[model samples]
Target: MGGSEKHAGLNNTKLTERLETAFPLLFASIGCIYLSVKIFNPHLKNKTKACIVIPTVDDLILFASHRAQIAQYRELEITVAGLAEASLFTSQKFYLNQNSHINKNLYTTVISFGDTKWNTQQKSKTSLRKYKINDERATHNYSIITKILKPRYKIVKETRNQKGKIKNPEYSYISIPISKELFCDNLTNGKPFYTDFYKLAVPNRDKSGKLKYRIKFEQKELNEMIEKINFDYEAEKIFIKACHTAWKHRLGKLGSDSKKPGASSFDKLVARDFERLRVALSKSKNFESFRETITDFWSRAGRIQELTDGWEKVMILLEPENWKRGRDLALLALVSYKPKNEKEETALKKLEFDDTKGEEDE
Candidate 1:
């Protein structure tokens, strides 16, 4: 189903499915509004020693999920030297709300690369002649179509090759020439952080010299490409996310029918997210009472299994006095806690094999 109309029709039983479908749109809208307000700031730019490393597109969800946790610690601004449109958009939106106090503009210490790369790949491949996006007056165009058309002014090629050098330093708060290599060394050794990025942006032609989005690499090749993106990445400046997919379990190696994501890997990922929440909440003034509520929970609600159940059990468990609004705390415990020496882990591994192999042999 689509939006509200479909949502209104669904019974309580299918609400979870509806939410899973709608999560992306909801996050995008929230993200857009957050970024839109960063324009009219009057304060001096923040020149803190910081960097945010986003290895891939999928990792954006994690950042969106824990944006509040990240905002609490607004560190230095690590210059994103090479700015493609999508990367620029994602970075600006992702890092826009780092500070709680937004009376001034603090995050404008940019190592500016013009929109040439993005513009060059476009149909018209032209930037506006009179109005160049080379100053603080420039606002990021959210719409992809509007950014491309140079209607008011003529388009021209960029005059300079400012790849390894900083351009427009006078306007910059903290201008530092950064290379793709420094953040993640893989790019220097022919292992770029954005493996599929170039192919999508500047595509290759077919045998007939027709533009088609079809580049088939081996499964092993894809694995290597993704692995290379983080080679020698300093986690301090470089944000590393765990592999989004269960890379090991694919269609061929596991079976004709692809196996489900490795259960252990997924559980461990959830454990990490929960652990981060624990650290954040521990500093709150309410933590003492919240701790007492958790202690009380063990006596009142069932074990970790009860905590792991859906919103129903969660609602019941947190409904008591002193635990009414501690759903976040309960969630942390739920994901982190597993039964002692989980039998399911070993049992699944033991059963892992090519189910189709037996049938093919017969």
Candidate 2:
């Protein structure tokens, strides 16, 4: 269906480190903090907080094999991202030609991996197996989703690496995002939308062949059923780790280590980050002082935003001059915005005039 590709709450990595460290900080003081925000923030007010994660190796396996389960949840649009994985092999020209025949959306994207110093390390014996690249199923699915959603596929590797033992966490890092409109309305020729996934009540007949009043469904009602979530920097990492852990948990729960998504795995992921951060300082003996606050941030990953918005907020709270500047910058987001039409422009001008007058009076 042709509509919109509204994406939000995206956090992807494009970072570098000069020296090797055991653990990475959100704002690694080791190297000057390379903080950049590009068209992403999960701060949509008065909406439910939830992440719509799609990429994970195990998920790709189930998605490819479990045709029945997929059909069961077809209405949820959870599998719309599956389209990304499936289209990996097709060519853009082939997709265009094929879609011309059927009313389907498809696009071909070539698979290529650019080698960076960080993601690769020299080893004496072992084949240069990529660290984050999982089984073939996962690799395939990742290709598909990245093509469709267009999220930043981040892989920040250390500037230097161990000669024999290269740390390969890059393969584990998959920043998953899929288009919302790609999963929503006009799909399947108005068959069923994500808004129609859960049935509140199945229509029933009262012992007669007559009919009962039908409760009509409205597409607008699904607006609040959001796809993205609001999370601070610390929370973002913790959230991603939690999701991966849940998926790796035994889906069957049949064996000891069989994986599935659930609350138990979520708890373990949080606890793991807590202890890891405490020991993260041990990466470098001298940097302990700098790592302390960041360690505390991860310890209370659940309450990061509740405590502070970003590092800027943390600095503002600790200083006087910074606080004044922070207040001025806060007003910038309020005062700076583009209006779509003259009606909005006039309203904005009046508000600006009133704001200027109030500021002068102050």
Candidate 3:
């Protein structure tokens, strides 16, 4: 047999040269620090070669365009020092400057190394950090980058019966991406709702020392709501107001206290209201029936006057065809947390007292 010819592998030096040639703008913007720290350091330790995979020509073009677009934003800056300080090359944490323009496309490139999922066995070794961004101008795009992680089971082995049918399957823990829109919603009182949504939806350990999730949602539902809002400006406005209304009502129930509601209480409120809306929509045969259900819900919640005055538009969004979107929006609104203002506090105080008096009279 003829001997097979061995080809030389592309080492970090060659890879760096190739990257610098193909993506000059990216190379210049991130500088040698990113290339040395993020791309090559791990290879030196593990004796493994790391390479950027441009899956298609279209992807390469898109990435080049994104890098070019990011270069244009003079105000948009990433601190290479900060990246090193955070150990972002090895860690999952990525930091950006506060009050900076966060181009979504730019973010995809910067955090490209962070995988959406990892083996459950590696959970303890993984560290995720939260950094604050204070740009109201970039709220919409900022929300789009916040991720939601979901736990999934992967089949590793299957036991077959004598008949050649599978009897028992062994599964292993893995993480998967659910959606990005979990935190992609309107700001509350001019502040981003990303932190609040993270507390509510993301899985965390509880007092019992076990991982728990307050609520769960599907990607399709959030995508539907996002699509509707993005296409129709009026629908976007209505959705925002609906979210605000739900937050107001939730805070109002707190009775003017400075104390914030805990995640469990918040989850309970969202679940109760979501179930009510879901059931109501599922049973309604037409627009009129849906309207009646909404009217009844609002009336029972003591928001009849608000419904009559301004919520007609919100009602329009809950029609038969848009019921699912409406339900998802309501779910988002109920779970979303916003800081209470002085005016809202005073109103809540009055509402609480009025309700107490009504109960006494009854």
Candidate 4:
């Protein structure tokens, strides 16, 4: 009996030891599962709510064109935050308006102006100096978005180089992960073809080939290009539109005339009168025919030809009737490619000089 009692005690001790060893592992496994669920839950939710980040007005237009791509997904909600004024001109504005199928109930929130790289630098009083601390406004802006937006998704590229150079002197492409914050006590200033959000969100590549995001406007270059042009861009755009309108009217009139229904023998005899009227009208000095002829002539002209060729083409399209097309085309083409400055001559030489294959190869 004594030996049996000792054996029973030993068995109980072994059972207790085994249970104690198993308890920690069991608790650890449960904790891991809990953490996994927390992480994955947000990811699953994001599959439904898409976040969109546009840095400029131009990008907003691009987003509009692609609005249809995401329209079908029922759970999709886009969060658009960028240079606010630019966004107003883009597709987001249109979507926010009545024309789109996007859900209106989805929330829209505004971020402050100083938060944007463009605005921060623009607001800064200091002239940009290399290797100096970035404009305080710019750094402050970055902190604001990082704190307020709390976006699970990110589409921006850091502005600083690996060596800490502020390449564009505006924009921050680099990113750091953040959660909802008391955050920093200090204020800060701060094009791929793929259809998927991931691919579409990829920003324009920089000279070094890394992705970059920021507004880099060469206002001087654009102004020079426009100044050198003899004619106005606005006028040219209007003229092209006018040509299209005239062409449309011509097609409509001709098509309607051709679609007359069956009629009497007398009607057939009288059709010659209609034919004569049509022929006279066709031969008249109409805008459509003029546009066609001018464009056709220009089309056959060599690609190496300058804006003068394009102008001449427009003239050919409009001319031979009233000569109006010819005059307009010539006037428009006159200043199209005029060099803006003496420096432009050197630039052109570099651009037009292609040195890849030598004369020996030729």
Compare the candidates by TM-score and give the number of the best one: 3
Compared with the true structure, what per-residue lDDT tens digits does model 1 show for residues 38-121?
A: 110112112211222231223456556655543443212223322232233343444334452211222222222122434332
Please write out the lDDT profile of model 4 over residues 1-362, one tens digit for every residue. Answer: 12333356444553233667667545432221000000111223222122122222223454445544444333212222222211221223333334333322222222221122343322111111111112333222323333333323334554777899876554332221211111111111111000011111112344564433211121233223333322323334334433333333333343445456753332232233323322223333456654555454334333323343354533333435534433343222221223344533333223211122121110
- Model 3 / residue 210 / CA error / Å: 3.0
Give all candidate RMSDs, comma-separated: 24.8, 28.8, 16.7, 26.8
Model 2 over residues 287-312: C-alpha lDDT tens digits?
33323533443343343443343444
- Please give the ranking of all candidate structures by TM-score, highest first, separated by commas: 3, 1, 4, 2
What is the Cα-based lDDT of residue 62 in candidate 4? 48
Positional deviation of 41 in candidate 1, in angstroms?
Answer: 28
1-362: candidate 3 lDDT, tens digit per residue:
00011112323332223655666545443331122112112222122111121211224444465445434533112211122211222112222324433323222122122222442221111222232334334343333332222223445888899998889877653322323222322221233323233223333344554443334434333433443333233553555455556445644563333345543443344444444554454445566775676556554455533344556566566667665455445445443323366654333222111222121210
Candidate 3 stretches with Cα past 4 Å from truth are 1-231, 246-297, 304-306, 309-312, 341-362
Error of 4 at 275 (Å): 26
Estimate TM-scores for all models: 0.18, 0.17, 0.34, 0.17
Angstrom error of the Cα, residue 229, model 1: value is 15
